[model samples]
Target chain A: MNMTTRVSRLRGDRVTLAHGGGGRAMRDLIEEVFTDVFRPPGREDQARLTSEALQEAGAQLAFTTDGYVVTPVEFPGGDIGKLAVCGTVNDLAVGGARPLWLSASFIIEEGCEIALLRRIAATMAAEAEAAGVRIVTGDTKVVEKGGCDTLFVTTSGVGAIPPGRDIAAVNIRPGDVAIVNGVLGDHGATILAARGDLALSTPIESDCAALGHLMEDVIAAAPGMRAARDLTRGGLASALNEMAAEAGVTVELSDEALPIRPEVRGMCEILGLDPLYLANEGRAVLFVPEAQAEAALAAMRARPEGEGAAVVGRAVTAGRIPVVTKTAFGGTRIVDMLVGEQLPRIC
Target chain B: MNMTTRVSRLRGDRVTLAHGGGGRAMRDLIEEVFTDVFRPPGREDQARLTSEALQEAGAQLAFTTDGYVVTPVEFPGGDIGKLAVCGTVNDLAVGGARPLWLSASFIIEEGCEIALLRRIAATMAAEAEAAGVRIVTGDTKVVEKGGCDTLFVTTSGVGAIPPGRDIAAVNIRPGDVAIVNGVLGDHGATILAARGDLALSTPIESDCAALGHLMEDVIAAAPGMRAARDLTRGGLASALNEMAAEAGVTVELSDEALPIRPEVRGMCEILGLDPLYLANEGRAVLFVPEAQAEAALAAMRARPEGEGAAVVGRAVTAGRIPVVTKTAFGGTRIVDMLVGEQLPRIC
Candidate 1:
């Protein structure tokens, strides 16, 4: 089927209250849009995965949750669906686990277009497939027009941590190196542009790709990797602060080595926002042993998602300043979690 | 802290744009409400559980998702929070698993009362505690005013199924009896009354209790139980139809044996609705061997959540009708899923 055009040709132009009704209409809608996209061929009620499978796999599950309420449901290079899948998967991946199954819950507005819903579902299907994870089960609820924006998706994921692999923010040591996979702030810039608040013609696309596959390789290469966290919500700055606080150490970043897109930097410069604090769906902050920094960088650069990976900084001795960024101009600035969200609903 | 009046005494009277910003305000709000209620005392970021616990327990995981957008966030016997926890836990329980941990994702509207949110969180804490499950992880997002209703909650739960316990709708067989854990339609009716859409003042409370403990007993008493489903949005009628359709058999209900309350029946009658089709939050429809039906009922009745448990019907050999209910008037009528939702956002 031509997925691109199929969504537009759906029967209803706008969702009605009846679509959310747990009845025939709702069932047909789900069958046409959701089940058709997520389920494999010839499976009925594919949501129900048996416990026997988990038992046989000897799964040591790492579960995490994320809420996506990005305004302008469709954005440059990514949509809410793509971000939802990647965000949750990355959460599990950073927690030292091999991502497996996901449960998605959608809150849709009554006036949301049926076509838009279908397109989002298609995007989620493709992304889940690309990430090698399954969207095993989901729930959908539609509310009145004023009740919500077009759509909000909440995803909870489960992954199995490989035996003997321990990952936690507390694992970082004073000498550990901090590495980021790919250019940061693209997701923040993309969402900003999509909202049309800046009215800039910048071509910054969101870096909202699943990083589980890349993390899998990184973990294998650097067995002593301390921990990892995706740059989301409050971004790289928040992540560094969290790691430092949890480990009770000081983290220092070399701004010259940071990987950032020029367009994103430009957008932030004009918008009075900091790239260090912008969300990145695909980027991850990995802490590795100081001796293995070069090897870890090489492993990360070998993957497409991590081709731009760089060693941004290192954990220094415990100090009063938890995080500091040494600027290219030969000065340093303390970095802390934003007292208030600079951008809301970006994820 | 007095959980009763603690909510109203919170510093902020209403949720603001910054509350969802992933900043200090958000952290404080969560700590005062969510973490305060759901977490163990004196823990930082208390919403994470180690996979080692699950591994030691030998958990065979069952994961399920549900979104709660029930209008009038506060209902008669329960609020959206209580319903959200019970709803997800019941999903796993009815799947023949012992409910364990849950991930709660909340979408809040700007200007939503902080006191209201804390109250909801308190209710959720109570419900999760009573159900013997942990609110292990969650995400919170806020939208601009008019972007959403007061609040919506999406919960995902994981549970462990005991060894050798296999349950699925496909396992249902001819001559199997259908048992309902308790009274039906109260949840649907309670929401309607709470919305003030119905001018009825009957003290009809939602049957929104977590049924995992009771289910554990029923499963032990009736190891031959074929399958089970919670009667949520579409209630008992839809469940029976689904089981029959899946098992490729005819399901016929004895009208006289149905355990619906007089108040619920009267509400349905006045609303021109069928109690069989209304939703039930704390009810379960179990398919079991007819010979063990009595034992199953006894096991269910031993618990308060299942006190009204009764044999409502039986599955027969393949027939033309998927579901048929005998009426009190000595007539048989086909029971199908409602063509449209009787009420939107009832759960």
Candidate 2:
């Protein structure tokens, strides 16, 4: 098939089993799909690995692993392949680890066209390169039809954490400022839109990207920052709740200061889903001493990934639970850690 | 509720959402149904953090992770909890790693009774202890009902490989002998029976157990062994195929030498499933050099876990494909990796 013909056919729908197999169909899927999306960056930025092992080792190493079982594998903005790599690299960066080597394992349903599997692998390899991570080892297994959806990816990453750095959500103290790297709920909303169940209108695409460089700058600006965690499965609200629970202190998020894109807010309102409980594939919440909040915010703004970075809340000793403001009415309310998945099959 | 009354209510039934919530209902379900059936020594075998870390760094480390979504959470012989711990640990052990710490993450459907969640966790903790492994960290999340079944478990394990030992399937030579640690297909058969289809009447329970000590013995006895792998989701047939493909050799087996419980064989026949393709959570396969095969077999025989160890096959260089089995009818045929899952959600 001609390049244009293949590209047209590939972009028209959700991913099928053929997208993962290692064959010709796989190649077309990668070139027409991932390569066109996650191209190399045009900026220079510092990267760090942030897991406990790297934090204590006084060395730079990136370590991350993520599983993806997103239904309708291909979505409006991305697919499982892109999410898997970005997810791992982002974890490494937020943990002060440098994005490095990655290993991917695929559990493909049987009769999945080999061409499709290859495409996903190729797309994954390309995304790894975009995020500056290398694909080193891989495994593939075929499950009988109905054993799984189309495919599931499990990725493990190894990166080097920089020296002389310590960061953890548990380190936050009363008066520490909570700075979000960027806007919220874009990914969750974008995915919901692609599902077409809500029948909502408005442009929304997943905010999926690597944040290693953004973290490096903020850490450099405020080396003594209290903590950092990627606001993922639980979103900003859930992330704050976990920090509060772990640190044994209440966290108060300012609704007025929180950053939510207009499109995301509109969708959340219409869908009856709280943006606070939504998910994000590429965003982080950092706790910094109030004095350094401005410097940290400025540092975040200086990076490509942190253009929308802003101070949204503060850690407190009162309340004994996570609390947030109702942006519309200025009403105070509980920002509970997501007890159950509002949407399962999310990354 | 009285023990008899509660027991009668739970036997051979479907799991409800309330069973997974972390509440009073969750507690009762665990205590009444699961704990009553799969209680480990002191009920400590379930997955629970034992300490800050597990084991001192020594030899190499073997690590593996598995996600379980087996249908019918509660089975006749074992359940998802027991299978999750034992399966991952077995993978590490067969790879020459002394299993150490385990990390568990659970996804519970909303409204799942808390009692069921506790039971699964308790079962996991007890099983972990039985295998001499510690669960160091865990995370739990709830998903909307129908987003997943009642529950799903993802377990990751770390184990230390003994020093001065090298085992890789590629090391297998033309004359290397292949021995199985125990009987096959009990676990798969029991799961099939639990499905209540085909009017199957097998009383076979899963043969799931941790096989670390057994591996240590074999490694010590046959220092020059080629490689080892536990037969799990894809059964001995697929594992041997992977080894053959990786090592660039062919494996030949005799039907007469393979170990299978009569119940398991009968179940396989009735269900139209091949025992070779069915999973075995408790068993392992060792490829030893011809000169050390006898020693390896003797060592395996001494271990309680390996009491049924038997030499079932040999590796040959002349064959192109990885697997071949001689039938009871005196004919040889290719035994390929299963095309798809024979028993979905097996491990």
Worst 10 residues of 2 chain A by lDDT: A41-50
Candidate 2's error at B74, in angstroms? 2.9
Tens-digit lDDT string for candidate 2 (A57-174): 3453333455666666777667788787887777677766676555555666645554565566667877787787765444344444655566777665555555655566667788
Q: Which of the CAPRI classes, incorrect, acceptable, medium or high, describes model 1? A: medium
Go through the candidates in order and give each one's DockQ.
0.52, 0.09
Runs off by more than 4 Å, candidate 2: A1-72, A97-123, A132-164, A248-256, A268-277, A316-347, B1-61, B107-113, B138-149, B162-164, B267-274, B320-322, B325-345
All candidates' TM-scores?
0.93, 0.76
TM-scores of chain B, in order: 0.93, 0.82
- How far off is residue A232 in model 1, in Å? 0.6
Instruction: Give the clash total for candidate 2.
Output: 65
- The digit string of per-residue lDDT tens for model 2 on B79-170 reads 78888888777767777777776655565665566566657777887888788986654434444555456666666665555555567776
Off by over 4 Å in 1: A1-11, A40-59, B1-11, B40-59
Model 1 agreement with the true structure over A96-178: per-residue lDDT tens digits: 77778888888889888888988999999999989988998888888988788889999999776665677888888888999
